[model samples]
Target: MDKSAQTRRNRRQSATFFTLGLIFIVGLVVMLSNVYQLDGLTDTVHDRHAIRQNTRLRSLQQFQAAGGRGVVGEARTRSVCIFARDGPAILHVKAVFERLGYDIRATKDDDWDVLWSLKSPYVAFGERLSKLKPHQKVNHWPGLGSVTSKSDLATSKLLSAPVGYRLPKETDAFRAATKANPDKMWVVKSGTHRGVRVRKQVDNVLKIRHDANLFIQEFISNPFLIDGRKFDIGVYTVITSIDPLRVYTYEEEILLRFCSLPYHPFDEAEVNKYVVTADYTPTWEIPSLVEAYNNFQYSHKQALNLHLGRQGHNPKPMWQAISDSIREVMHAKEDGIREIVRKRFSHQNFFELVRFDFIIDEKLKVYLLEVNMSPNLSSGHFAPNKWLYEQIVYNTLKLVGLASATAAHPADVSKDERDMLVSLRDIQVASDRCASAECDDNCKPDICQLCQLCRTPYFTDSVKAAFLEHVNRGNYRRVIPKPLEEQPSTVDVSKAINSTQNNHLMTMWFRGKCEHDKTWCT
Candidate 1:
């Protein structure tokens, strides 16, 4: 009896020990598997970061040695011809060459003597260059032209009217209208036949044409604003090649021009001059003040809204919404224009710099004001401010194969250069700033400019890794779960039927019980 009991006890103890050991081994393997998974994830993330770092390094190198050219030692020689209207815009172009150490001379025949056509100092031709117009011959060399006849080309007419168009000249009739309505805008015009002058005004501007037989558009009022201040959107697209006229880069810079309301205040002397001077218009007080008066008398409600507010009511404060709306519309139109070139003229590249003008209303609707093909870049309003223009010029040179490959990378860029880059990027972002709207506002260049300025190789690899790391540390990963695959559940008709029957029975029983025994006391 003792041996049998001993053997049974030993077997029970052995069974218990074996089961416990197996359980412990299973738990250990599970824990090891989890550890392996976590390590693998971390390693994968690190590898991704390394690859991104390598890519960014490569890009930086490419940017520095733009077009694979090393540093530019001196300006080179190149030949180019440009057609443009003689105006303030041309003066900016002249300044670009003078700064680059090039000789710029305006020729009687409407040609500019540019020093370095190939990485040399150059002049921005001050002629009206336009897309090939209807009923005009395609300009093959020196670019498009309005001068068809050899004699016309020989004359200043060709250069004076490159688009074969001219705006109206000032006249007595126009002066009278202007005198009658000094605040209101007026139009002037001129025409010619067989080189004979014939000028007159038509009721409709659309029907009128200048001496070059081309219509001249009147400058419209820009009513767009920012924080109730007047502003314009400058689409700075770079033309890397004019012969091919490829647009290499596209940027939108905002020019927020601060103008006081039509009637905030006027200097005492200025007001006295307007009041006492004979040259003063019927009511030459302050434009803003006059506008305020008109608004109050005609639209009392609007005047009240513009005058009464915590900010002391800005009657004609900057209109940011309108400014953006105008840019959005122009962006779409420019896309169409670019497409026409790509499809019609075989230009597939983007412009290096292009600036469009727009005005917006209180409702945020944009209106096309005018197109500034070449904006001013004078000393005060220099297009390339300190570091800002360096990027433009550097990027332009890079695109044209004039700089080193890594010209885009700003790491090696001088501190001053980097500051300008930062400002340019900041401008883009600031332009996209809106009180309430999607970031995709016409000022999307803001994001691109910032990315370039920060030298973050975009959101490709390193960016994603950094983001994930932050998310994990911040517990964001727990909130944002990985996507799961959708799986269809098999239907159990019998179960469903039974469940329905059970519910029906419960309801019927409850009703019957209520009818038979009100309180179920019995």
Candidate 2:
């Protein structure tokens, strides 16, 4: 009775042990792979941001698990009143923000500490905008004429697109609009489309300006191309404070958007897409377009490498160039932006996201395409060939000092306390001080020469200092690059951030059982 029974029992135990061991090993491998990013064979969507977000999430969880409190006691946290605009990006923003532990609401009360808005900074100053256009305003700003305090950017090695007609005596918008540069191309942007390049002809130019709202700009013809596709570098810039005008650009997530079609200067058919879009490729012409998209496209990092080889420059200089171009444009319209911010958005305090588009010529020179007011933060931006909207927004929130859930409670935040944070009235007091002559953001020797403050030496130095302060910063891995702390600690959960509309369901449920006899699951 013993031998045969004992052998059968032993075999059963062995099988059980083998199955348990295999499961343990599989689990261990999965954990290691996720933590170490060992999926090198294929980089999927999650690799772009999930890995980093998960790391941050785990760190936060571990901090709370370790008994550390976040933003507790008298430290106090803040809640932002977000007035988001309509679109897919904002939809993503609302979803991301709702998950966080804050009082996410829509309000214009004076007590709100911080305001995140999608409304144009100029909307409140529409009367002003109507009275004078962008070019018109730039031209008339005092001290912008030849007798100025600021030095020109071109004097330095920094490449910049020439801004025209700002000096009032020489200003004639019509003449400026009609005259063609060597590029022989003009770009007109009115309400919504990115922009359209027009040939140099007075009739064509007048027809465009007839819209009244149109901004006529010179379009660059000699652009650096990759695989014959026209592309631009999209930089995500954040303005934490406008009083001193703080702006930062993310270096790591610099997005490169390429055109769907090959770069052909004379091809009128491809104009709209070429006016600007890198995320989508044309699907027309059947097999050829599809085949072109498949073969021509590559990730931003890959494109960067290709561009680097083509330009023989490092990431540092390229980013520095891009940042310089942004500053130059800002210098040209400083007062206009400040007025828009002060009059319309003049809250006690707020934050803003500015998306700057730039194109490079075959000479590796950087040109500012435009500063997008309502930046579309869809999956494609700030990181080419990757979905990183979550990461981008997360980083922005961290930079803005939105404390974590552990810091404060929703009931704790009130409209009364927020009124004390810095308001436009407060800034106006200092505004004169900035203009009184002696403040500069972080101006350097190289940047000072490029400072427009020289042109308007009589104008406020505080603002120009901010513009000139960010020069010669060799490209950074990320514009606002800061890796997570080495060890776990309380992460500010006020860390990251929108929305609305609705639909309804009709009617009544009749309790009749069992036509199909189907039941719901647990």
Best model per lDDT: 2
Q: State the C-alpha lDDT per candidate.
A: 0.33, 0.45
Tens digit per residue, CA lDDT, model 2, 355-447 = 777787776767765555546666533333324455566566555544332334433433332333322232122233234334455333222
lDDT of 1 by residue, 1-522 (tens): 699999999999999999999999999999999999999989999999999888877765665554322232323332123244455434545444345444444333223222122111112422222332211111122321211122222222211111112335433444455456445422222222122211223344324544544333222233333333343333333332222112222222233223333212333223221111112121113343246435444222233234334335452232332223222322223333434444434331122233334444443334433333334343344332333334344444333332322233212343344344233333222233332254434324323322323323322222222222222221011000100111221211222211222222222322333344442111
Q: Candidate 2 overall Cα lDDT vs. reference?
A: 0.45
Provide the TM-score for each candidate, comma-separated: 0.28, 0.50
lDDT of 1 at 91: 54
| Residue-pair clash count for candidate 2 | 20
